[model samples]
Target: MRTAVELSWRLLRGGGRRSMVGSLLTLAAVAVSTGLLLFAVGANHAFLQRAHADAWRHPGDSVANPTAIEALSTDYVQGEPVTIIDLAALNGDAPVPPGMSRFPEPGEVWTSPALAHLMKDLPADQLAKRFPSPSGTLGRDALVHPGELVAVIGRTAGDPATTARRDVVEHLGATGGPSRIDRFETDASWSADVYLLLAGLASVLMVVPLLVFGGAAARLTVARRDSRLAALRLVGATPGQVVAITTAEAVLTAAAGALAGLVLYAASVPLLTHITIAGGGWFAGDLWPGPPLLAGVLAAVPLLVGASAVIGLRRVVVSPLGVARRETPPGMRAVRILALAAVVIAFGVAGGGLIDMGRAGMIVLMVFLVLAFLAINFAGPWVVALIGRLTAATARRPARLLAGRRLVDDPRSAWRTVAGVALTGFVAGFLALLNAGPSSGGPPDELRVAVPYERSAAVAGQAEKRLAGIDANVSVKRTETRDDPLDADGPVTTTGVVTVTAPGGTAAVDRARTALTGLVPGKVVTTGADEDVTGDRLLADLRTGALTVLVVSFLIAITSAGITSASAVLDRRQAYAMLRLAGTPLSVLDRARRQETLIPLVVMGGGSLLTGLFFGLPFAQGFGFSGLIGLAAFVVLGFGGILGAGALSRPLLRSVTADPAPRPD
Candidate 1:
């Protein structure tokens, strides 16, 4: 073990360019995977942390609607759902609510790091927006930004001892008379569990691609390694020794990358804190992962790498002679079809019983989702084999014939090179169908509104008064929604919506919306209409979130194709050299390699599209499936895959063809 580790380390530092490149590629792949996995995981944690922060911002206070004019000047702080929030006074003169321990004083205020970060660092003129003072005077401008702490106004300004006891003289201007103070924050329409589930699902998508990346990293220079290990076998090194040495190399590379990834994550905290979600970016502290999870991530990455490396050598370890005479890999079995068929039947049976997507049904759905993903993996090689056979039978030229023969000869290797691309396409296709689904976007007749949670009565009065002025005949209804946590099919934190009846027409409804806007200095969103709200932000984020994983998968697919394609040529250098000596054209072999990649690109890409639609159609919401968009995406991916493989195969083709070197005995 010691000898193997020493040799591995020595080889990593002292090996020639090819060996060094392999090590670097392995390190790069592992680092990228680790960093992204952590980011997804960290973002999940941040969502919850931000939620808890929102919950803690007000304790013991159930009513958030303001009744006084003093806090109104600076009271309009934006909230999680982007509503205007008015702080209340804990002043002795004002009648305080029984539920409140203490409220913020007139000039005192609380804010998250995201808000403070956005406001504090600007010029003196802009600093005024950080905490607007009713009395035109704020304390000295802050030179340094606070780290993770919630920015508190009046910390350096207000005299807490005297301010709470100070007299409250009534002053009415554009606003009405001052009354009792109350504050309430809107609870997320859905529960934490739903967001948590979404985060988990997103993480799975990212982590799966990364697992493939790590696997590819382990096999970076397999053919060369096989040759090197074969020479060792002939020179009396035991099979176990060879495996130990390779595993040592993979572990060292993976460990270095994983550690570097942790460093990168730590460095990215400041930036991550600025990604606006919910209503704002997360606090720096809110984004930090706990020690146990961090430790687990660090341990898991290298172990995965070492295990994959060891597994890649199974045949070699079992028989050293067999390693030297590696055969064309076997094609996938017919069992892949059975697995897919079983999934469809199970989905049908379970769909019938699980009519309502209750907790049990959701659990079953989750299982089906996992099965669908696995089925794609299981069924991929089988489809590739069938495509290969079909193409071979149909081949009319040398390039096509050679490519078809290669696919049929070693379908598993071909599948390995392009599987990531296929999976990415499938995932992308399924996601596109979401927007196509019926219930995804807002409805036409409903208008979305975010009124003060406790100001339901006030909002109704104001809304009615405004609507009465409008030339159009429109009425507004206050919408209240409640979620049952125990119900699996239940709604998550759903945003409240106002149903606007434009009895007059669309023009009348438009006039009514204008009147409502003129009544308040706040935002109003209309569902099925043009209105901006948190849902828009959340959905946009959800749609793009998978893109990062897809990109990582694409990179891995390209890298794997390039390295493995180059290795294919290098592995058969002797055979190519002999062919060149017999006057075979370099272009012929070049075309052969291109054909190999092009054929698989078509086969795998088509299979991916089919699979995506299979899963996506059954699950699409009331929104019609966007078959056109999916088709376009599939076409683009297919073209890109083919071009990428052909491009990567070019440089290696030149080197292998240009050199007619003798093979080592």
Candidate 2:
């Protein structure tokens, strides 16, 4: 073992410029893959943290012996949602909320840092006057994200605002009445669930491509490594010694790369916090995956690299003479095609909803989706080999012919060059067709507020008196009930709705809205536009998430293409030298190299895109004009990125073929 480690260190340090370059390239690839994987995992953790933080606002079943009463409502200021939680202690022993140091005195309010900042910018009547002067600021544990707007106000038990009444429009998990609770802990809101689902899907999409890239990192400069190992076997080195040397070299390099990746992820956290989701930007701590998960990722990446390196050693280990003679391995079997077909068939059946499994059905669909994604890996090489054979049979140019023979000689290597782009193409297709339908528009200038059913006439009279001085046509009416557009079957019972027609537009609307603030305790004054805010925000969030996923995928794809293309040049240096000596032009070889990546990229990338569209059909509404535009843009960008990556390696190819003289390993 000691001898093998010493030999490995000596070889790595003394292997000249080519070997050092290969090692550096491998390190860079592993670093990129590791950093991306951490980011994907961290995103999932961030969403979960937000969910837990937001859960306190949604109280669960009432306690038998309650100590406090809590009522939740929402207010809108400058088009942003502000969650207001009204609380009254029934006893001195009532439990304190998550971020408060103690139970609040009546009329006291605590605001999130973001809300306090907004209050400083806006006039008192516009926002600050809606609540009593903020007595304290809520801690991070009480807020979903750093930018979330939340306020906790203390009220007397008999305060009108504490009276039980349904909201005009239901926000997430709003029950429309005060709940008796002994504690703040509860399940997360439905919006959190939606965010979580999207996060999980994004993680899966990113993780698969990153894993593929990481494994491919082990195969960089495969030809050189294989020859060097074969020479070791020819010199009578024991198999165990050979394995030890390979493991030491691969593991050390991978471990160093993994550490570098850890640093990269850590450095990116500040930038990641700027990405808004669910109407707020993240807290720095939200993006940190704790020690256990971080350690696991660090260990897992190096082990994966080591395992891949060992797996690629079969030829040298079993038939050293054949490797020394430079024989091409047997072609990959058709079973790869069969395996892919089986997975696709299974996915189709599962997605068809043959059974009424409910939540189980969703789980099954997720499983099939993952299998289908991985199936692309199994199918890619087979498709490349088939493309090579067809190209070889029909190619008329030297560039095309050389490209075909190289693809046939090593389909796996060829597949690696395009795999990232192909995967990203699938992501683009899946996201492109999903459109959140248009917002349900309403009378933009109208303001509606819900009051207690028993006091509808009284509240309406009070509202008229309060808004009498406003320079607008304000009408107050008694409304028996208002139906929740989100929940068609559940109608919220309210006493009255204050309707304001502001001829002066937004300024007048603001005046009317201010006049009606605190008219009914515990009731929110909302505009007709407020009803559409949630839906519009959801759509906007989805678009943002889709863009984020596509950007990350493209980065990975482009990085993979560039690295693999350059590595392929290193692997085939000797071959390029021989071809140059045979009088083949560098231009021809460069064209051949580009064709090798381009041909498979178009064929497999298109296939993957179609498959993604097929999978997304269940969720897609008709494609809007924007959707089509986005789809076209993705295609252009995907192809352009791969072409650019392949082009980056042209200089390396020129250098390799610049010298045609042969050299020993």
The numbered model that scores best in TM-score is 2
Clashes of each: 14, 2
What's the CA RMSD of model 1 in angstroms?
9.8
Local accuracy of candidate 1 as per-residue lDDT tens digits, 426-511? 66665555552212445443444554345545665667676675543233444535478578777654333344554454444444
Q: What is the lDDT of residue 598 in candidate 1?
A: 65
Clashing pairs in 2: 161-521, 161-522
Query: Which residue window of length 10 is worst by lDDT in model 2?
Result: 168-177
Tens digits of per-residue lDDT for model 2, 414-469: 99999998888788787877776657676767777655567666776776777786
Model 1: residues with Cα > 4 Å off, grouped in runs: 11-15, 57-193, 259-276, 279-288, 329-332, 351-355, 358-364, 436-538, 546-556, 559-579, 622-631
Model 2, runs deviating above 4 Å = 168-171, 174-176, 352-362, 450-457, 476-497, 503-507
- Quality of model 1 by C-alpha lDDT: 0.56
Total backbone clashes of model 1? 14
